[model samples]
Target: MQRVLIVEDDPLIAIDLQHMIHDLGYVTSGIANSFDSAKRLAPHSDLALVDVNLVDGATGPRIGQFLAGEFGISVVMVTANPEVVADGIFGVIGVISKPAQPATIKQVLEFMSTYKHQLVAHPPALRLFTCDRRGPL
Candidate 1:
């Protein structure tokens, strides 16, 4: 089973994400509201669902880079601000907008599970990026 770590600041949102992930048949490694907690839990996860504006300011991009580059973890940015993708951070495989529906989350995760190496996007909704292909959605 794939283990996912959620890096979200809002406790309620994190819980909702956890429930969604569980419903999709993936294991929730844990939830982190800040960079420090994310760093600590990154090692135990296969993938990470990150929020752009974390409790510690806008550090989600940095955390995503670290988790992907250092730990070889797959990263998907889940944020209200999709502009973070413009930053061109490394190791982010995809971006999912905030308030993600169960179907959307399931779709993204299904894509991640299959095309873990390629850059895949769900369009106007979820945008994906890979090292080979990097640009705005």
Candidate 2:
């Protein structure tokens, strides 16, 4: 089972995401409301669902970079602002828009599980950022 970390500020949303992750057969490593907390939990998780805006402001990108660069954890941006992910932030595998459906979440996870090194987008509506070993694809 893949361990996933939820890096969201909203307690309610975090709980919902936790349930969704569990239902999708992924284990919940932990939930972190801030970047510091996320850093502490990064080592234990295989992947992370990061929100662009958190309790510590818009620090999700930084956290994603740290997790992927320092710990080799996969990151999928789950946020209202998909544009942030479109900025071509390093370490982010993909972006899933806010109010994610269960199906979309599952699809994203499956894609990640198969293509761990490449970037992808969920729901097909959002822009996909693909990358290869050399660079963006």
In terms of TM-score, the best-performing candidate is: 2
Model 1 per-residue lDDT tens digits across residues 18-97: 99999888998899999999999988998888998988999999899889888888788999888757655666876888
lDDT of 1 at 51: 94
How far in Å is the alpha carbon of 27 misplaced in model 1? Answer: 0.6
Provide the lowest-lDDT 10-residue window in model 2. 125-134
Cα displacement (Å) at residue 114, model 1 = 1.9
Error of 2 at 12 (Å): 0.6
Instruction: List the candidates' TM-scores in order.
Output: 0.87, 0.88
Candidate 2 regions exceeding 4 Å error are: 117-126, 130-134
- Kindly report which residue pairs in candidate 2 clash with one another: none
Candidate 1, position 85, lDDT: 77
Q: Any idea what lDDT model 1 has?
A: 0.82
